[model samples]
Target: MDGFLDGLESKMRAKTVRDIRALRSNANLLREPHSKSMGEGLFELRVRQANGIVRVFFFFFAGRRIVVLSGFVKKSQKTPRSELRRALRYKADWEERFGHGRS
Candidate 1:
């Protein structure tokens, strides 16, 4: 939870709530402990699918529920490393300026 992921949880929650009210109800269900599956705890990425595209998202569950860490629309070339770096930097700047998710 360093860069872009810092405040992403709140963004996803807010946007997910404001734009997709219907889906909002289902979000909690998606947060179930067993709902998330991962081989190792190193990465806990989640994919939100819509139409024909998939939006990649991660969660920070070092707390009560899964907090959406960050998100991006999947690209054909597998999400360039530069983009990942930028995302991380963005998260860092956000934290430096605003603080954390609650901000």
Candidate 2:
């Protein structure tokens, strides 16, 4: 996420940041071009800039807090399998330590 932000023009970067904030506030409220569910409790946040698209993969851990796993700029029509695995691994690790669906 940091690297993607660093590569963006300031204005577009600011918009990306705002979109992320909107996601943090209400992830469900922001969808499609902004957020997507990748199944197995993992999701991705999409940030569009004039230059290109950026995606941050994350998962909901205990208390429904968002834990960002990894990020990459979109290079192809698909989100890489490696990125999804990374997010799932993080989700697994989190569940291992904290237990699942605790409220």
Candidate 3:
């Protein structure tokens, strides 16, 4: 995710950071255009700028913490399966290390 953010252009990066802050502030208050669920405990934080759209995948962990898994720039109307798989893999790895679901 750090690499992803670093690769983004300045304006887009700033927008993405602002959107992420909004997500952290109140994920439940974020809906549609801003956030969307991918099912199976995964959600995407959507960040759109004049340049492009970005999606940061994350999941709620123990103590209601948001664990960001991966992020990618959206190049198509639909999200690529590979990215979803990658996020799921990260989620699995996190669960393995920290214990699944809520503590």
Best by TM-score: 3
Which stretch of 10 consecutive residues in model 3 shows the poorest summed lDDT? 20-29
State the C-alpha lDDT per candidate: 0.41, 0.78, 0.90
- The residue-by-residue lDDT of candidate 3 on 1-103, one tens digit each, is 8899999999999998888877777887788988999988999999889999999998999756889889999999999999999999999999999898675
Error of 2 at 51 (Å): 0.1
Runs of candidate 3 exceeding 4 Å displacement:
101-103
Q: Report the lDDT tens digits of candidate 1 across residue range 1-103.
A: 3343343456454443342333234544554321343322212234443432223333333332334344454456355565455545555565567555441
Candidate order by TM-score, decreasing, is 3, 2, 1
For candidate 2, give the lDDT.
0.78
User: For each candidate, C-alpha RMSD in Å?
Assistant: 8.7, 2.3, 1.0
User: Which residue pairs show collisions in model 1?
Assistant: 3-91, 3-92, 4-91
Clashing residue pairs in all predictions, respectively, total 3, 0, 0
Off by over 4 Å in 1: 1-45, 48-50, 56-71, 100-103
Residue-level lDDT of model 2, residues 1-103, one tens digit each, is 5876788778777877787677667875767867889998788888887787878777776565777777777789998898788778878887888788567
